[model samples]
Structures are given as C-alpha cells and as structure tokens.
Target: MNRKEANQPSPISRRLFFSYAGTSALTATLVLSGCKDDESGMPVDMGVDLGSGDIGVLNYAYALEQLEAAFYTQVIQTKYSGITAEEEQILTDLRDHEVAHRDFFKAALGSAAIANLEVDFSKVDFTNRTSVLSTAKTFEDLGVSAYNGAGQLLTDPNLLLIAGKIVSVEARHAAAIRSLINPKSADFSGDDVVDTNGLDGQMLPDKVLMLASPFVKTKINASNLPTP
Candidate 1:
C-alpha cells in the first residue's frame, strides 16, 4: 500500500516514530507531529509538504542545511566563553560551509524550494561552551543520519550523487564536533553511532524533525514527503 495513505491525523500532544523500510535498502524512523485534519475532519494545512519524489528529498536536505546554517551563524555571533582562536576559526569555517550548503539547495530547488524557515534557539544557551558544542554535535549527527536515510528515496542518479557529496561533508562536521567533545580520542567513528560494518547512523524525516523542531519556530509538515 502507499505509505502516504497510511498516515492519520495526530493530536497536538501526540507524536509517532515509524521504523519502516523505504523504496530501497535505507530504513526510516520518522518523527511525525501535528494533526492531519482539523475540527471539521477535513485535511488541514500541514505547513510545507516537501513535495513528493526526488524534489521532496531535495527540499528535505535544504531544510536541514538551513537549520545548520542558522545554528552556526548564531554560534559565531556570540562566541562562547574561553573559546580559542583556533576553535573560533574552525567554527567560522563551519558556518560558511553550512551557508554554502543551504544556498546550494536553495538554488538547486529553485521555484520548488520551500520558504526560509524561522529558527527557535530559545532553549540553547550560547554563553556556555559545553552547551554550544553539544548542540553542534547533535545537529551534525542529525544531518548525517538524515542524508543517509533519505538517500534511497531519490530515484534521480544526479540528485543521489549530490546527496552523497553533502552527506560526506556532514559526516566530517559530525567528526569535528565529536573530536571537540573528546580531544584525546577518535570517538568520531565510535560504535554508538557507526556500525561494526562501518556505517554511520541513519534517521527518518520524522525522527529528525522531532530533534530539530525545538530549535525551529516554524512548524514543518513533512508527512507529504515520499516514502520508500
């Protein structure tokens, strides 16, 4: 059956995490939020659809890239306490890279691109190093997982190649953040995230959205995105 047809209206306080196989080898554990219908029991606007098929996948990437860019931009703006010059420079570079990524997706999607999302950083404490680095780590890891999970959903070879390129960069970002948290060791490829076969973590759009929504003021309706 079409997975989209299986979606049901959700309550404001209720959410779902679905672990299911997609069109190919990649598996997804989606974090679905918001109600599918209104009081009239009719289909309500679920915000941005992210479309369907390959275009939906690109918009998905674009949304996360935008979040990462916004996050790094804020980090650079405040500069956590006792941050070294090297750390500052590296973070600035990360910020630039995220912006480039965000813009790349925006350009690639063109008219099909979703609108610029507003971020909610109210929960983040920018004054503390530990807090900032932890958040960065979370975001990077999420990015890597998101790309991995969404990969097989894209039927377009060129789009998949582009995704491959972006996922590599995201993995690097994840490693860098992990290194910062543990300077003496290479926990970047730790067993917790990477499998024994040497695969990075993967997450469905719903799962990613749950982790990311706290930082984003905008409500995202990702239910309309294509499933495997």
Candidate 2:
C-alpha cells in the first residue's frame, strides 16, 4: 500500500478490536482476514488477526522486532552528525541483532508469520544523536519488558527457551542505549527499570500494544493472545 494509505488511522483501538471480533459469533478459524469497525465505533482500518495460541504470541514478537529492526535500519542509513565511532558500531550491532531476531521469528513461523508491517518513523529525527539514542532506549526497554510479560503466555517449552535468550539480548541492547545517552550511567540493570529485588520491568500484551501502536502502520488484533 501507498504510504498515505498505509499510515491512515484505524477505526478501532487494538484493545477493543479483537475482543469484539471474538464475541461476534464468527467462525473460530483464524486467518488473515480484514474487516472494518462497526459504523458506531471510531472508523479504524482493520488489520489481519495475529491468529490464536502460540503462533499468535510469535506474531506479536515478530511485529515488535520488525519495528526495532526498521528503526535501527533507519538510524544506520542516515547517521546522526555527532554520532561517535563507538555509537555507530553499537548501533550497527543493534541493527544486526534486531534483523536476526526478526528473521528468526519469520523462519520459525514460516506460513504463519505475519506480513511485513509498515512502520512510521516521522517523530524521529535520525540526524540528531540525542533523539536517536532516546528512541533506541525506549524501544530496547519496551522489547525487554514485552518478552518478560509474555513469558507466562508461552505454552511451548522451546518457545520459552528461545524467548529467554532473546530477552537477554534485548536487555543488553537497552543497557547499551542507556550508556550511550549518559556515559556515566550503569549500562545494564537501570534503577528505573529494575526494582529493589533487581527484577526487570514487565508489561502485559495489551499495554505493550498500546505503547507500540503509533510506530506500526498495520493494525493488529491481539485479543487472542494468552493472558494471566
């Protein structure tokens, strides 16, 4: 789809989108079907379902990794003017990691994987070091939290193992971004993100989607994902 067409706002919020869809008495079969919101609701352009069960969770991770990959790809494409050599190298590594993670999910899901998601980076100024690092920090932190929160929803032991490995990598990325922003700061395990018990922050799928909505061009219905 064209940029304008892809970027248009969806009529329904992610929270209500799949929740209502599930209750519609429609066929339980999951597929990449699109539908519009009812006339009474906000005119959200409906996107495909993330599907149900473990595959849905994989799609969710894939979607977020896609965003991270896209963001880092953009950052490297147009390096910020004052970016240090260390910053460039680390950002390049981050880009590579995100791309690998994205591809890994795609490979694992095969036919079940979601389509390439459109990402909107209009709010970011790629040429500005501060802006880029700040945004990177935000994404890395969000990614770690997303995986932590979704861990309980994964039924497959293998999937949980894979997720654990990926979350550690994302945590390292977050620390690196934090260090870039503040050279004197502790890189990993930030006080803001970790509690007195030293546990990292966590966020539910709905909350993650809400925070992630702006960057994604394609609407996602994640009501089918497992919750606590």
Candidate 3:
C-alpha cells in the first residue's frame, strides 16, 4: 500500500540542518517532561484497528508516527533556551516532515489505522539540555532500527522503498542529534540493531511496541505479522 503523487520539497541548508536538530532536541525534552503529566485525552476515534498480519505492521508504524508528530508539535510550541535562527528553521522543517508522515499514514490506512495514541513523557527534564538531546537520539535511533528491521518483512517494494527512504532520514536525524550530545555518539546503528549479514536488523513488532509502550497507553497485537 502506497500513494501515487506528492508535492516537492525545497532545498535545505547547513545552518538549517543545525537549527532543526536543536529545536527537535528541545521538543523531545518538552514531551518527555509533560506528556507524562497531561492526563487530558480524547476518546479513541477514527481509522481501522491494526488487525493481525500486515495490517498490524502498518498500524505499528502509524503509532510511531503519532508519537513523533506529538513530540515535534510540542517542541515547536515550547522551545528550549539557547536556540538559534538556524536551529529554529530546521526544527520547523522536521516538524513539518513528521506531520506529513503522520497524515500520510492516517490517509493511507483509511479504515485500518488505529485510534489516536496517548503519550506520557513526564519523567524527562526539558530544562536540561543533555536530557533533551539524549532522548531525541534514542527516538531517532529507534526509528531507524524499526524501519530497518521491518524492511525485509515488507513484501511490497513500494512500501519497502517508502520505509527505506524514511529510515535514512531518521538515521540522519539520529546522527545530527547525537553530535549535539557528544559529537560522537551516533553509533546506535551497531550490529545489534543491524543483523549478522550486515543488513538492517528486524525487530518483531511486539518488541518494537514494548519499547514504545512507555509512551503509549495501549498494547499492540502483532500476532498478524506474516510468517516468512
């Protein structure tokens, strides 16, 4: 399942890159801090439940997109201190990209997409720079791994290509954020996350959901993943 056409994106800049990274880090901090505290939530509505099999996998990706979209939205709304012009711009771009991904999945899933996911990140400290950047690094890294691991399981080349393109960007985000934190901690793409054949590792959907469970309130059923 894939879409046929889309708008084109404008060129990006070096300064813009840095700006996006800082702003994104700032946003992750906010979510990690407040999402956990906000008890207000809407009733689960719209789309299809992630049935077992391939449908479950799509729902898994959608769930992740929801979390990411929420995180970026909060970051842009309440930015961290010491943010520069370049950082602001790039963060804006990333926010837009995440929003696009979220909406794309929502549209594609039609009746198969799961309900709105509630996220809680109350344990994080937004004021602290390290915590924000580190958390961002984790999300980016996990996203890359998730896409990589899920690739082979995807039989549709179109879907595979879509996942592949997105994961590369996720890896880029991971690298940029990791540099901010330590200038050298972007190695989350290790053998563990990458299988023995030097291919991107594939984590079962259940395991991926478990890693994401801290933020999402609902449990996922991956019993539907196709048996290879």
Best TM-score goes to which candidate?
A: 2
Model 3, 87-156: lDDT tens digits are: 6665566667766676666555555567777777665465555666666766777787777677767655
* Per-prediction TM-score: 0.81, 0.83, 0.69
Error of 1 at 178 (Å): 1.0
What lDDT is obtained when candidate 2 is compared to the true structure?
A: 0.79
Task: Using lDDT as the measure, name the better of candidate 1 and candidate 2.
Answer: 2
| Candidate 2 worst ten-residue window by lDDT | 1-10
Which regions of candidate 3 fall more than 4 Å away from where they truly are?
1-49, 184-201
lDDT tens digits, residue span 1-228, model 1: 121111122221011111111223222223333347778899865676676667678788889988998898899889999999878877877887787677766655556778889898888899899999999998998899999999878886666777787789988988888898898997988888899898887988889999898988878888777777
TM-score, model 3 to reference = 0.69
Write model 2 residue lDDT over 1-228, tens digit each, in one string: 121121223233223333322322223345764566777876565576778777788789989999998999899889999888888989988887787777766656667778889899998899999889989988999999999998988876666777888899999999888988888867567788999898999998899989988888788888778778
Give the number of the best model, judged by lDDT: 2
- Once fitted onto the true fold, the runs of candidate 2 whose alpha carbons sit more than 4 angstroms away are 1-30, 36-45
Summed backbone clashes in each candidate are 5, 6, 17
